[model samples]
Target: MAKITNETKRYPTDLTDEEWTLIQPFLPKVARRGCRPQADLREVLNALRYLARSGGGWRMLPHDFPPWQTVYW
Candidate 1:
């Protein structure tokens, strides 16, 4: 897991380390054949949770989360 830099702002919906650990196993594993790197599952989950909790539109998601299209995918 990548160490979160202190510079990265934390969002209200961001999962705690324990929460992420519990859910990490259920997330899909990265395919070895992909040319591009996989997006961080924690960030993706955080984005989804933010959307669910805020009831915000995809375009209106805060800049802190991954791009809306990525989360949508």
Candidate 2:
């Protein structure tokens, strides 16, 4: 799979660096064991924000964001 990058702002729902800084402290840290996470938390959050703001179906999510299943569950 190609590497995913959260460096660019592709949507209006994406968090600004300052916003992420304020929100980052509240998110859970990665586990030291078990399966690693498949997606970036910030990207997932942005997907969610886009879905909420647009009121679109999960499967209809744009190609730029992570897969819909990743954001849905």
Candidate 3:
């Protein structure tokens, strides 16, 4: 039997370049696109990962990321 690490159990959330291309049109967009965009799905997923690793309070997360409450449940 193989011993699975925590990393192995986590969901595969990394979006590939091609995969991102397909989902880009459908995901919500932030205003002011001329300069740069913030809060893409990748970032949100990353934040969720960090929460899982640290086991911290959702509200403790910085406001820049999505509500941890939503991500947890």
Whole-model lDDT, model 3: 0.56
Q: What does candidate 2's lDDT look like per residue over 20-70, in tens digits?
A: 787889999999999999888888888999999999999999987889999
RMSD of 3: 9.6
Q: Give TM per candidate.
A: 0.82, 0.84, 0.37
- Residue-level lDDT of model 3, residues 1-73, one tens digit each, is 1222445433344444455566568866666657554334655665676667677778886664567665554
Q: Residue 68: error of model 2 in Å?
A: 0.8
Model 2 C-alpha lDDT versus the unseen true structure? 0.83
Candidate scoring better on TM-score of 1 and 3: 1
Better of 2 and 3 by lDDT: 2
Clashing pairs in 1: none
Model 2 spans > 4 angstroms off: 1-7
Query: Each candidate: what lDDT?
Result: 0.79, 0.83, 0.56
lDDT of 1 by residue, 5-38 (tens): 4355387677877687788898877777856545
Pick the lDDT winner: 2
Off by over 4 Å in 1: 2-9
